[model samples]
Target chain A: MIDQLIEAIIQKKSPIVVGLDPRFNQIPQAIKEKCLAEYGETLEAVAAAIKIFNRGIIDAVADEVPAVKPQVAFYEQYGLPGMAAYLDACQYAASKGLVVIADVKRGDIGSTSKAYAKAHLGQVQVGNKNYQGFPADFATINPYLGDDCMKEFEAEIVQEDKGIFILVKTSNPTSGQLQDLVMADGKHLYEKTAEIVAGWNDKICGKFGYSPVGAVVGATYPEELSALRAQMPKAMLLVPGYGAQGGGAKDVINAFDTKGLGAIVNNSRGIIFAYEKIGGDYQEAARKAVIAMKQDINDTLSSVGKQYW
Target chain B: MIDQLIEAIIQKKSPIVVGLDPRFNQIPQAIKEKCLAEYGETLEAVAAAIKIFNRGIIDAVADEVPAVKPQVAFYEQYGLPGMAAYLDACQYAASKGLVVIADVKRGDIGSTSKAYAKAHLGQVQVGNKNYQGFPADFATINPYLGDDCMKEFEAEIVQEDKGIFILVKTSNPTSGQLQDLVMADGKHLYEKTAEIVAGWNDKICGKFGYSPVGAVVGATYPEELSALRAQMPKAMLLVPGYGAQGGGAKDVINAFDTKGLGAIVNNSRGIIFAYEKIGGDYQEAARKAVIAMKQDINDTLSSVGKQYW
Candidate 1:
């Protein structure tokens, strides 16, 4: 899965992943009004609007970016209708020849984690047949539950050739409240988690020396980001906090290796709702945002003397 | 909500909560075959069977136990149909006058956490009206992302008079991998988490002096359970790892206050699937199992000189 993602990055000459974190307010007013007129300003109406808006964004940016990450929370806020929209978004992204990364930071005990793995990445068994719940090539996971919790994903990732990015250092301001605590071993909690990721990746590396297991290192913390990149050399970094979260291109560029292919920066509001700031058709604005982000990241990579390895 | 839960516990004279962690394979052969025949062995069939099984358990034990903790993973494994079953089971249990605690263990950043909280305990607004997703009195939360992650839940919990049990010391074997680490302040990670939980609960305590915010302390760790009980005196403890997870009556008693209150022990497989060990109808076996568990826990509490506070 990591190899395939890297190949897509190399082919597109872009390491940007458009985050589809669509909120009710972020959807174009015209679309919202149309859906509400049809469905009577209900959860159903909001969800329908989200699905259509997401399809437009995916269609406009699929050829420019390698993947689209649908933050599950936005859709999940509306309930079953919202989740239905989330599933449709994933399917449509996949249909557009783009990787779908479900940003569902789910974690639990071993048995429960297995259920979540099946729900997001793997297949769920019903009678003699298997069904994909929310089909995604990669899903984000939380690692607070320890190794046993992740064993479920390890088994499925190996079986299905899927991938997971474990949360190491999140982009949120208060993430350091726990993640940055100094451990007894003199490593920050995030560094210890990074080491754990490195160890897990040792068993699942692909021919390109990248692993299906990855780590989420925030773009907001450049010093920690550089250190984590060195610590987990084979782990692909899903760098969030870019653009809208106040992380600049220079800060995120350090997350990559000399090859500039190790990190994929995620920009949600900055790209998906760019029309709100730039004033244009939302889909076209999203496309333009993606192109600008790609150029900015590429320029940073080149200035740092990095190339595709 | 916590006061109501405690009063119910005192009235029922049982601090045990039945854990509805039903697996598809655990469904009775008769029930499974019937559902499969009717629904053609699809996800809908499995989910329908699960709802019926959960309703039976809830009906059989509602008088004996004060609450039901439905581990969401079991229902989630079957996909949308499973989630629909989960919501039905919760509603059915609530209708039976039992407190429903949805054991979701969900955590994320502030904005994302709000969606999860609304999805479980509170209600989500569409346009004109509000809707509850998987309505429950309380939902379990993971506090790995720190206070900001829980702030969203805290606000909603206060407004809705709902409750939450934050994961402090989980029952799983490898939980210590991150949870038990010693922090720079010389406090173990769980202890730090307990302090944080205590601080959060101060503003939410009810007239009975118990807070709606609670801690999940594994019954398996008796010493830690005792220490945590002392640490967060005002917080209710949801003690898992009882029975099937290897925590016996004596081990779990430490989680209770001198009043034999402030803690609710959860037993899933041991009670729900008791028919496997003792031959009889599944629901009857479950009822008998619940009665036996109640007797055992009461005997233990009496031996320790505890009474209703």
Candidate 2:
């Protein structure tokens, strides 16, 4: 899956992954009304609307991007039907030949962690059958619980060829409160996390010199992004906060290697909700938004002597 | 809800929360066969089997414990039907007057955090209607993203009187990797987290003096538990690592206050899977296990001159 994600980036000439994080209020009124007409002011209605909204965005951008990350929290807000819609979006994106990243941010210890690994990455077994719960090629995870806690996720990566991006430095303003704590060894907490990720990255590299294990260092912090990029050269980075969260193309330039193969920048609302700013058919607007983002990133990378082609 | 939990502890003379973390392999054969017969060898069968298994344990232990902490990982392995069963267990435990702590350990930042806060602790508004996704009195959350990321969860506690337990000092062997890191400010990471939890605890305390905001300290680390107890006096502690995690009654003794009202100890496999060792009806074994656990904890607390009644 890591190799496939890298392959897609080179083929598309775009190190971009659209984030399918739908806020019900931001959903188009026409789509919402149609769902409400069918399901009538219930969770099902909200989920149906999100399903359509996600399909529209995925269809528009699948031809231009390497991956699409569907955040579980947005779908989980509506309960079972919402999760059903989330799965539908993942499946639809995969059907379009795009790598699906389930941004669940799940982590725990021991067998409990293994259960989550099976939920998003591995397989579940019943009496005589096995089932894949959420079909994600990769999933995002929290790293507070430590390396031992992530052994199950590591096993899934090795056995099933799946991948995971562990959070290092988040995009939020106050993320520094904990992540920036200077350790007694004179290293920041995120640097320590980056070291841990780098160690793991060394264990599993694809033919292209990238590892299935990756780190998520938000593009909002360009200096940290560059520092972390240097710290974990072989680690593929999943950089959030690329657009709506106030991170510009120039800010994210540090995320990529000179080969433009080390990172995938994600923009959620900035791309999916582009119709609000551009004023057109949502699908066409979303398509145009993807092209614009691809051009913006590629042009910036080119200025730095970085190219995927 | 904090007061209610305190009251329940006093009434039952037990500050014990039975961990309803069901493992499919540990479920008795009879229940599995019945579900298999009804739903065949599908995820449906897995979910139905877990539903019955969970209900049996909930019925047995509800009378003896103040709460039941159902870890989400186990239920999530089966996807939607599994989640349906998880909700069923929460509803059933609540129906039996037990506080349902959804041990989800979910954390994200900003509106993403708000979506998760809504999923477990708050309600979602859809047009003129509102719906609660999962009926949990409290949900456990990770704290790696820092305090500001939890603002949405804080809002839910004030708005709906819900509760949350944030991980501080976990019981895992390698939890020290990140949690025990010595900061340049001369405080361990967990102490910093405890201070943060303490501040949140002060804002929304109930009449009994404990706050809806709590900390999860592992029973295996008794010394740290006692230290953190003094640091966050108003915050109730959810102590795991008891029994199956190798923490015994003696190891968890420091988790309580002089009034024996500051903490709740959890034991999952020790109680739910007791039938395998005790050799009896699963329900009866679980019931006996809960009573024995209650007695063990009360006896230890009484030895230190602590009393709830």
Candidate 3:
């Protein structure tokens, strides 16, 4: 799956996966007016507007990027109608030949964890019919419950050909309070987590020398990124905290393996609603921003003597 | 709020807060058939059935118990419509004058945590109108994200007369793998967390000598419960893993203070759907189970020379 993801990015020559976290109030007035006119104030209508807005973005970037990540909370805020819209958006993006990563940081213990795994990544039997869970190639999981809690999710990754990005180090500013705390062993908590991540991936290394089990290492901490990358050479890195979160392409360069086959950079707000910041037409601004990001990443990789698509 | 919770429980003289976790498949065949006949196969209908079932239990036991804890996951399994049913059930339970402790187990970083806190216990503005969140007297929270993640929730407790139970020692078998791991300070992880819980409750101590900040200590760990109680003398305890999880009322006695006024026992399957296990009429089985549990808890408390009720 990582190979397929990498291949798709290389073919498109863009690693951008537009994040659709359409905070209703943050959306541009023009889009909001149109959405309200079309759907009205009902939650369903609002959700439909969000889907339409996302579909427009997907339509414009289908051939330009590898995937789209829909943060589940943004949709969940609106309730069921929002969930239906999110599912629709995911299906639409997949149909456009783009991978969909469900950004739901779910973590639990044992059978409950299995239920969550089934609810999100695997099939769940409801009555006589077997309903497919969210159609995402991968998901982000919380690892605070410890490694034992991840066993069920790991089993799903093996049996079902799915992927997971365990939270090794998050992009949030206060994340370091707990994640960076020095353990008795002298290693930081995140370093300890990364070590376990590497160990967990050891049994699941793929043909491309990467593992289906991945780590979410923030792009905000470039120095830590390099150290973590060196420690977990086989784990794919999902680098958030890019663009809007103040991380540049150069900062995330060391996160990838030499072959540029082990990392995926994520820029949510910067790519999806670029018009809000860059001040141009929505599609044009998004296109330009994505192209610029691709170029910047390519330049960073080349400068580091690493392969770049 | 802890005073209210303790007083209500003591006044009623029952420790059990029937947990509403209606797994669609696990529901008895008779109830399922009746629900299917009444509501059809639609997710909304099934969720409505769950709401009705919970309402029935609340109505039957409202006078006998102090509270009802509704596990959010079971409702969330159906998505938005399910959440609506959850809201309906909570409102109905509250209407019956039963304290509703939403068993959400939610935790996130900063603003997101605040949003969840508001969505479950406080308030959030939807538009020109402000909409009430879950309106529960209390909700369960996961504290894995560290103390800062709880600031907003703690603020809500102060501002809104609400409460939160932090996950300290869980009931699941694998909980010990991470929670019981020895930390650098010679104390176990949960012990450290329990100490934090005590600190969080210091300023919020109620008239009844308990605080709004509570600890979720599973009934399965009696020794830990006794020790944790000693550590957090003023923090209320929500003891799960009772009845069906192989914990008797005796196992949870140590969680309470000497007055038997500091803990609320939770039994999901043992109370709500007792007919499935006891094999008789639904209401009859539920009523009998409630009576037996009440008696058992009173007996245990009496044996310990503690004043219950």
| Candidate whose lDDT is highest | 2
Cα lDDT tens digits for candidate 3, B130-211: 4454568898887666776678797779988999998899887767755675655666768877877888888788898888
Off by over 4 Å in 1: none
* Alpha-carbon runs more than 4 Å astray in model 2: none
- The C-alpha local distance difference test score for the whole of candidate 2 amounts to 0.90
Position B242, candidate 3: lDDT: 93
Every model's TM-score on chain B? 0.98, 0.98, 0.96
Give fnat (model 3): 0.11
DockQ for candidate 2: 0.82
Query: Chain B in candidate 1 has what TM-score?
Result: 0.98
- lDDT by residue (A1-309, candidate 2, tens digit) is 899999999999989999999999999999999999999999999999999999989888988998999999898888888889988998999999999999999988777889999999989988678998887999898888888657889878999999999999999888898899999999999998898898898788998899999999998999999999999999999999988899999999998888777999999988999999999898998899999999999999988888768
The lDDT of each candidate is 0.88, 0.90, 0.78
Better structure of 1 and 2 per TM-score: 2
Top TM-score prediction, candidate number: 2
Model 2 residue B186 CA deviation in Å: 1.8
Docking class of 2: high
Choose the strongest candidate by DockQ. 2
Clashing pairs in 2: none
In the order shown, the candidates' Cα RMSDs to the true structure are 1.4, 0.9, 2.9
